[model samples]
Target: MRVARTHHRCARRSVVVGKPKAEPRASWVDEETFDAKKKRASLILRRLEKQYPDTRTALNYTTPFELLVATVLSAQSTDKMVNIITEKLFQKYRSPEDYLKAKPGELEQDIKASGFFNQKAKSIRGLSQKLVEDFGGEVPGTMEELLTLPGVARKTANVVLGNAFGKNFGIAVDTHVHRLSWRFGFSDHDDPNKVEQDLMKLFSRAKWFKVSHLLIDHGRNVCFARNPNCADCVVNELCPAARVPAVRKRAKPSPSA
Candidate 1:
């Protein structure tokens, strides 16, 4: 009887341990035709728009220079924290000259709470110097110009261009953008730049700026990094990564209004 009871318990344990609730998927990258991908992507964006109409960067800044600084500080930090740090940083350093003029080690101290203050300080100073000398103290609006700034890359460049300068050279693939891109099967790449390319293929140039914002808003509100509220997602049926069973077929994508 003891042997039988032990066997029964082990059987129960094996059943529970071997099973998972569900797996997230991302298979449409190569499966869908280019036109179908565009249609689905358009549908996804429209639904996201309905829920998050005022899609924009969460960072707080009043000018291009301020926006540039805020985007720089946002690295390895949350927008809320960046905003908190910038609330004071912006008031003190109004232009590239102001950052450059900060006493040695003073800029680091000012942004120490933002974390990685030393490297951030150097990047800020280096970019400030460049902006002052090369660009006449104004943040450059073009992608090529923004890329040349110290501590700036495609992501930061896109943010500055789209939000600050109203240009949509490319999408900004921050962590949220990166996550949602794969979930939506927009890109199979792990690299943000590569992912941005895949995303660029799915939308018109005019929509590039808005796509980044829409994905970011949905990621923050519903598709969390953990325990995402899939059932409540605006495009759950279209998302392979959703924990629930998907409709498993394409629906007629609505035209963009």
Candidate 2:
């Protein structure tokens, strides 16, 4: 009888721990190994392509020079705020020469709503003067030349090159993009340069510009900072950061002794 019981116990143990079960998938990046991670990133890009087919520049501008200036003014300011200020500012200063010729204080007051009036004033004036002297009052297209201008970093240059010139030089890592990319497991690095490198490796060249805009829109509308609406999120199935609440406790009936 003991031998029979031992045999049954051994059978139960075999059933319980025969083969190792696969790890529970908590994130899209975890769905595959390193090589497959790149492929998964491509799939995510495809999903975004359908979601935001018309994804483009949020900033309004007619000319490349206008777009370049607007991108510079967008530093530490929202696109809406910059647009509000630029609506009149653009009408007044039609060209780089006009901006260079205008009084610094007047231009400063004109863009006061966008914040950092003093520094932004200097940047606008200095950048304009450089354009007049160096590029013959035209915004430079290449990344190398664009960086030579004051107040024009990788973020601004990338925005102008991608949106205005339709060039895919690098990814624009805005605050929303940086946060969302990290949450979505696109990158572990906090530095924008490193993040762009990771994204370039994962996504194809065609998605370089569009990917940032899609992520930015999603971050603002859904995955907001401080309080994300993960419950109603579209990508919640693949998101590791989805908020899951604990189940409610139920009262148990007393057992008869």
Candidate 3:
């Protein structure tokens, strides 16, 4: 899929208008009323939509079960890595029963590159067994049911619900979403669950699914954990963390006449 380029039209709004542009104040964001936060979040989303129109879950999957397994492997590992492993992994195990049939040690080795392979292997097998036994070999659609699967948490559940089932129960607060939430002033807490709640309150339920993808895309491409590319950020003006000045270049001394 072709990812959209960073549109300059979106960047224009990110620049502060006046000389000595005022730095974004986190304290001001802390004091913002619900209405103000909602408005700011709407603007941020609009700009992000323009910047990354192709935002999506980077995990490669053709089925809900495939997505569930891929998401489980994605924990503590990059999506690119997970995709690489799943390319071969999916070709072998196409169903929950297939996973359940595999020997633990063999399955562990299959996804070992994803890191924490033992725990992840246990989760995948355990959840697959549960799916076959309880949910009739299908990944559950509801949050409550999905959470019952071993290793499934709100983050994973939200991901499956929104992306797999087309149900927007809540925003999936993965590492990227968690960081962007704080940077965007949507939440003050570091807890993913609390951050997810704050974001749900700030944006409409209809936007919950796309919100995670947009923030994830922006976080990966621009709002990095260290030294964020604030100048290039599409929502820099609306981002509370964009207060930091961009990296400056020193001019070379004029060559002696």
Candidate 4:
């Protein structure tokens, strides 16, 4: 009886101490998720670059000063509106000296069509004053100096530096750039500066110059703010959140209660 009890105890000890069979470690990610993100970014870059090979600033200007002035005027207005206002304004205010001499009311009227003309006039004048006082009446090339001017922020500075001076300090994250970058899952930040940092990490500096143009063109033509035509888009396959615009068969009647 003693020997049998010992044998039973040994059997129970073996059951408790024996190692469980090893289970295979499952992978968190398969090839599908990895391939999808890669393909999406590639398609987006390729399609956009091909469509707008010559895409650039639409503001018509002959000099760096004009570019600077136009960018300032484009704060809340469209490029088309700014262009129209500047058509005659440029001829009248030929230099920073001319801007300084003009009456505030007169300059306000000149740029009235661009909306918020009064505020814009003040910003432009203030910026021109700084240009004369600090940079000898010339648009500064570096980002640091450009940011010192009135009405100049990182976005404006990036545009002036990249387009006017051919420097790629940072990507210009305008409304279009911001919207497109987020829609494509490139970033989730609400701030333009943060979005720019995210894109800078993903893309090379060599591609920064043309990236804004590509995004602008895409925003205008395909990925519109209200109704994005995802089904017709070239990169729709890779985009997980690509929403196909639903075609309405008939207009719904107003409720008469």
Candidate 5:
């Protein structure tokens, strides 16, 4: 069992920006030739691959259904918190039928520690009900089918498809992925979907699944959203954001001075 204390996201947490979110391109990610950008992306991944060879989703789950629930619970919260909640949660409700049996607001209190419990509870129960009514209680495997579930966006769908189903439909851009993608100059756009597209263009289809996991591991351990540990980052040399700052020009003295 993974202990809550072992998860780095719990040590440092950030709120989730709402979906269809828009974040402007980082100025550091200056315009470059596509070939140049892709090469840098490849080299960064090569170094990070060595740095975080064992990276995987930090959330604990044995089944696709469990992953779905844990991911929905992970929004605006840490994976450690989600794991703690699910440690008991998975034991109590093992199937879609079980979640549908929860009374209104009952599951909310159970998941309150994950934050935004009200919406998260609604999403869980709603998706579980859909799974029972539509998919014969099995979590749908395709991106299209998974998106039909209440809390399943592309990011969530990507996580389920890539990790749980072992299909590389796309890269899952969580907060960590979003931040690191920009820092690594993988994608300039902050919109997760767009960022996913930009990144998909960089790497081959086979490595798509590994991209997010690698970046996320790097983000938690090194390239943080605030005061990132650039000095120790594995790909710092390739990271435009981590480059040594250009010397600032001296300001002209005022005429009076």
Candidate 6:
């Protein structure tokens, strides 16, 4: 009887210990085709447009030249901070010629609150000099010409082109746009240029400019970097990462009474 009871307990222990583990569900993005992703991207854009009606650059600017200077100063700084600095800076330096006239150190001191003051000051002075010398003291409207200016990459160029000139060259992949793109499975790339390319392919040219603004607004209000408000996300249903349940550790069994 003791031997029989020992065998019964051993079998029960084996059964409990040998239970099969559950397989992880495939990511929603993994199952989607190119056409499906495109369609989903369109749906996401439509929803986002409804959520944020006003799509505009947060940086305050009156002229294309002011917008260009503000964008240059906006690198590695917040729009609020840039706007604060630009308010006074704009009043002082009205044109590219004015910026060119100011000394780099004086300009650095003027924009010290924007962070990266020295580099920003140099870019401002360098680009201002270029604008005066090459483009007749005017901010160029074309992407090609804009790239020729110092500190004017695709992001800054796109911002100026889209907001100032009402042109859509490409999506401006800022920090907000970058984070949301990966979460939405629009782009797996870490590089901003590649991410912008992916977005351009996923969305139509008409939406190229407004898409960045929508994503930026959403990122700020909902999809935060550290703690995304997935529950209230506008695109939660379409998001692949949204369906994936957050993994939590199982509690250890307490000591038997």
Residue-level lDDT of model 5, residues 1-257, one tens digit each, is 12232233342453334332233434545777789888888998999999988877887888888889988988888887889999999999989999888887789889999998998888998999899999999988899999999988998899889878789999888777888776676765757899889889999999999998888888789877767777777776677677443334589888994
Put down candidate 6 lDDT per residue, 1-257, tens digits, no spaces: 01110000000000001111122223877778999999999999999999988766787887888888888877777777777788799899998888778864789899999888989888888898999999988888999999999888999999889988889999998888887787788887778889899999999999999999888888788876666787778777787656444444589999999
Cα lDDT for residue 212, model 5? 87
- Which residue runs does candidate 4 get wrong by more than 4 Å? 1-42, 245-257
Off by over 4 Å in 6: 1-26, 243-257
Which residue pairs clash within candidate 6? none
**Tens digit of per-residue lDDT, candidate 3, span 14-120:** 10112111324457787888898899999999989998887767777778888899889888787778877988998999899999889749999999998999999
* Structural similarity to truth (TM-score) of each candidate: 0.84, 0.81, 0.84, 0.79, 0.85, 0.84
lDDT at residue 150 of model 4 (Cα atoms): 89
Best by lDDT: 5
lDDT of 1 by residue, 1-257 (tens): 01110000000000001111144585555587878878989999989989987777787777877777877887777777777788788789878888878999999989988788999899999999999899988888899998999999998899889987789899988777777777777776767788889899999999999998888788777887677788688798878677765344569999999
lDDT of 4 by residue, 1-257 (tens): 01110000000000001111121111221233635544566677887787767777767776778888887888777777777778788889878889999974999889888778888889889999999999999888999999999888888888788877789999887777777776676666777788788788767788887887677777766776666787667666545446663344577988999
Give the C-alpha lDDT of model 2.
Answer: 0.72
Better of 4 and 5 by lDDT: 5
lDDT of each: 0.78, 0.72, 0.79, 0.71, 0.80, 0.78
How many residue pairs collide in each prediction?
0, 0, 0, 0, 0, 0
TM-score winner: 5
TM-score of decoy 2: 0.81
